[model samples]
Target chain A: MKRAASRLAALSLALLAGTPAALPARAQDAPPATRPSDDQAEVLAKVEKYLELAKSGTAAVRPQAARRLAQLGEPARARLVELAGADGAGLAELGPQVVEIAADFGDAGLRAALWRVLADADFPWRGSAARALAKAPVADEGAAFRGLGADHLWQVRFAALDALRALDLRDARAAVRALLVDQEGAVRRAAAALLVDWGEPGALRWLVEELRREDAYFRVPLGAQARFDAHKRLTELLGDDFGFRPGESPATPANAAALARLEAAARERAGDAWPSELPPIARAAGASTGDVLGLELRSCRAGEFYLRWNDADEVHVGTGNAAVVTLAPGTVERLRAGIERRVAELGDTRFWGEAGCDLEQYRCVGADGELRTWLLSKGQASEGDLRPAPLDAVAELLLLTLPDEASADPRLDRLRSRARAALSVLGGAL
Target chain B: MISLRSLLPALLLVGLGAAAPSAEDATVVQMVELNNVEYQIGDDLPDWVIALDGQRIEIAGFMRTGTLEGETWFDLTNDSCGCGTSKLQHFVRVTLESGTTSFTPDELTLTGTFAAGEQEDEDGFVESIYRLTITSL
Candidate 1:
């Protein structure tokens, strides 16, 4: 029994480090006396190769390396745990990978290490650690997991809920129930789904209402994606799709019929337990609604920038780091006219040159409420002679709207320089 | 002797006349159709997805990046941010036949030849179940 416990611990540790810990399950099912001896030299060589790959391989290669390393059992687990416990640079270099791999084991030491990592507010891999804890839940840590449910980051809160679900403690139900009111739509959906999974009545109403979401971020269909996720969850919990197609508009006759059938099914299942008239689905924070024009620039290395202007002449800028600033007015009309003229000048040529790391996307809502999109390669103007004047002008205007505090950001400066260089090449003024 | 350079102008004119592929020539595949399924290692791909193998296809997705430097190959995923647990089925491995490209956080529309099924690497790891080969960007 002690040996089995140790093996479980090792498995949890491996999982925490993001390594495949299934090898330990095989070991646990069989007696140690009948275990086969792996060739020492072969094991050592394989460990070295996988460790190197896990450390520096391409994104696609790293997960595979972690799996292969975990298959080596004790040697790989020991090495990962040691690396995870390292101080300073050594820990920083391999902390995420080690924590992911160590999650598979139920070893007290591994659990303690993960707990420490989870508690560290400054740790970059706290989310990973939180997820690892979920995979190998300890009854004693229910309070800790519950505490994480209230974390500021929705990702952490979601991870905490997952851990509580895995732990299956009776008291954690209220904690999970409270998150249904979470500000983030994703988290609210997750909380509702979890409650439904625990056989709580009336939670199904939340997902049903979510199907009508039409919220967007310019051209990105965030609400549709959310609706799809909700439908997927509903289908899984109910074991029926009810002929619902997420791609179709919710108001379509076919979709309305399908949703009616789903609602009937839910009502039948819930019997007298279903709640009457659930609260309306809330739009995600900062989602665009009735915006006249939106422009976004995504830099491969630098990050993402979003600018949205409404008919109210309100210009909102999102730095993609959760930082949003409202700029002073009076520039919206000039910017809109400039963009419209430029768009007219560059007709039907949406794409230019080859694909690059940076992308510029423009979205505008027409009088008929139709959304039109123009996607362009941000590096194309500099790479080739095909000058996209609209993209350059928009970039310049977006930079110009930055408040005094955001002007010092290096990313904005790089964008400003690029926009100026392109305008200078075109002999155009902003 | 006829020089190939002499034929370039006519070729360019012909290319300009038919620069973009017609809609009917390529099937538009969405990432949700591919990703919204439960799949495990060694599980056979669904028949509907298998039907897309070797077909000319257009897909829009975000490029999953490990580094900012250019690469000849990259993974295309439905999720812009790596928030959820990624599996082999969650992404399609895309290889360029010509020049390399770097990571782009914005959505990209790519036209390519699609291949489906498990492809294992030299070390016996399943690299990806879906693959795409494009002649250009």
Candidate 2:
């Protein structure tokens, strides 16, 4: 996998270098005209200045830099593409802004570089590349867009739909329709909105139904955001909100009435074409029982870990792949009660620390079957002293449940030691 | 029993009382409210959001950073992927008043005094429309 990724990265660099064979056929296929020496020096200075600003300035300033680079025309763009090639690993960090700059240029060479990034499976910014590709003219991109629409990551698939919409490729209707049942709720909503724009009135049912969704990752209200996005899209496209307020709890009587009115309006719009049954609401994959509690720590560079315990005295633990082990009788009940008490004392805060690339996510199914979630930065727990008290205690308890034989596994042993150290700092026994 | 070490910060804040805002005093704000509006550089922010200026607020979001070490400031964004059009309104530029924070991959809750309005840099580029100043992690 590493070798394959390296080769793809190299190929992307080659494309950016404007190798003759790598160039796509377009009316503006010629390389950007070279500037006079003094003008070249001036452009180079401007590029250096903007690139430095993009690196040091506020994150919002990166877009401004991208605009300035776009205004500098092709020499600056060639320099950026060269910089991207020299530091392939930094591409993930710089890809979004660089791609945005490329999107503004009418240069075919720049678009070709985007295609290479989009095609490389290991590229971290494929979604950004896909969205950027939308601004440039499309030529044999239908197959590529369709393939990206089926990418494993919902973000990539979502961006592909957006690209198709921007390109106004009405011929891709079948491809968009297939995504109405996408596994991710947000993607499904995006697909529905796109199809509705294509004059498919029946697709309005998906948006109407999404307004009533209450799916959550613990207490995060992910579904609420999805509903909000759907509502916003519907309002922008149709200019009528039907009184559906996304901030209100979906289960509230007021939202229920609003949803009914929205559904009626959708049905009227669909006329005889409304489906007899709506597609099932998409949900994240996991155990949904009220008796289950799961913690997932995901670090893209370091790998991922998951621990799940339930009422049946079963504990599932894994890094990458999971193993289920039955715990000692009555252990689950005791641990669950203790953890519940600690969580309650932690209060209503749903997330801790500022966002980063790594995550420490805790999800527990409450007695009422509502999933309550808490999120903390994984780095916050890297040190024993800084680990959140409630999370440390819960993690320690869960670690203790591992049988003595678990120590035989190196990964499990490391986790156990880490939890032990954290608990000790809190003056708790494991 | 809760650890005294973990409770020290809250205890110290209580001991100080009205001298500063406690964690409990921070109004919990949702990222949705800040990002719901599509804002350009020169456009006026919604009145509801502008009302939050200088108020102690707590908000949750993912941090965007190029590095994980010795960072005194970072951008907090609602979406992790940062796909679609990234306008000036999409991020809240957070500056720590004292110590720096390392980057973490999980969702974070930050409590601080918020300033809402467009602020430009030397180049006339809008740096951020919303800003936050926090004392510590």
Candidate 3:
């Protein structure tokens, strides 16, 4: 009976995070400690247990538990963020879960928790946490983010730049201004994006610069053997937060024309930059050598780190040119940027707004389309694969993901054989 | 060599020609319904994505199945692709419904048309996600 009651209490707490949790304190009312709200205690107790379990579950029962606690609402936010960011923390492992819980918390708790997350060492997690706080449910939520303008982790601090978009309070101008000069192109872009909205003094120039880097560094080629996090999208981008809603009106004619113009302009712009598309660093290697690629700052490769999006100028396997690519100096940096951008765009509430999908877990799918059994989790991407392969086709395939037992794994063998066989056939045709 | 520069003109020509000899502007696709079977992300990975079931779905141009969900539905029609190349058709996934009543399936393919946005406004990053007729199992 007690367990059932506790479970019910936890469930209620989860629901409270979404709807209002009756924050009835008329300034004269007593605090929880004095009154002993039975509900808060039950939730706290259950949530603590959930956090502990979140550490050991095999297929991720614990992560789900943390999510449930998140649903319980505001009171649990402090606990959730604390545990999710524990020292020697596995931010990547706990990233998706932390974001999930953060999204579930109320503005009061979220605003504070998101602040701490902004300075976290982990880029992926910080980015996720920042994006969550961007659309925070309350006003003046920018305080925590303001200090993050100079966080140590590049991605984490970068996320702080992104957080400014929705949380751009008048007082937060200093933070946004500082980020505008950030070394990372993504940081500058986010800072500029917010400046555009805020109409800050001299932000467009910075935005343009960031945009320049975005286009130039966007599609730098992958080296012969480059492996990045292929499981980020699986955890962060995937999920059921299907952004569609009912009762949406039809698109206006003007809207159609505008979208077309954007498409055409993007094409023209990408084409113009085809010659020097990538940064010089990315161009130093194999198939990625001197490809006329353009860039767009979005997520790819499982939303892990960004990929300097390099393109083959519309090279199609069947279009006679099996595969050709070019790269520049910052191709790898651009790739990393893509990952960062993708991580931030997931739940902006600005573009898709209320329509973003509810993020769940991450997964890994191969070229032939198979969800990798393990190594798909967000945590795995952060610290697991430290060895970088040489640049090459086999390298490209390997980068899609690294099999646990490269020799014994059927997925790796299948990918290797198919890629080799395909390349061989293509090479023969060439 | 046919560069993307050259290809765009050709693609534009095709687009303009496809507008018909009726001396008028051009046309388009959207996802409306499904029933009885499971939702498949794409032909290659035939698995149901439950979140998209029944609920109206909207997505970007190119989509790969990931465990995380937000904008879970991305239509791979011409302009929607992030790749800006032949869509791997790989950027595909579908939500399934069980028998007309609920969405539950082993595998289902998404077939839909998107409301192409106009290309003229300053704040015109607008693309409205529309109805997807569910083909449930």
The candidate, 1 or 2, that scores higher on DockQ is 2
Per-residue lDDT tens digits for candidate 3, residues A20-46, read: 445343312434334326666566766
DockQ of every candidate structure: 0.08, 0.16, 0.05
Error of 1 at A402 (Å): 11
- Over A1-430, each residue of candidate 2 has an lDDT whose tens digit, in order, gives 4333333333333444557576444312534432234555566667667767654455677778877877887656565555555334444556466665665656565577777776676565565676677655476787778777877556678778877887787898988988877655677888888888888988887777677665444334556676788888878766788777676665678677877777787888889878787643332233223336776654423334556777888765541123456888888878877778878978766555443334556666666766566665433124333346787777767778865444544335555555444334332333
Separate clash counts for every candidate: 30, 11, 113
What is the lDDT, from 0 to 100, of the residue B5 in candidate 1? 62
In candidate 3, how many Å is residue A66 off? Answer: 8.9
The TM-scores of all predictions, comma-separated, are 0.67, 0.65, 0.36
Best by TM-score: 1
TM-score of chain A of 2: 0.62
Q: lDDT order of candidates, best first?
A: 2, 1, 3
Tens digits of per-residue lDDT, candidate 1, A1-430, equal 4444344445444434455445566645666454334454456556667877765555456667776777778766655555555332233355344456666645566677777766665455566677777776788888998998887556678888887888876578888877766645677778888888778857887777677666566645666677788898889877897887775567779788988999788777777877876542232333455577776655432334556777666655542112244445656666666666666666765454334334456766655665555665533133444336666665566557655433543334444455444333322334
lDDT of 1 by residue, B1-137 (tens): 87886544334423322122337667667676577656877788766566667767788777653324467888888744442345777788899999897555456788898899989888777778899999867
TM-score-sorted candidate list, best first: 1, 2, 3
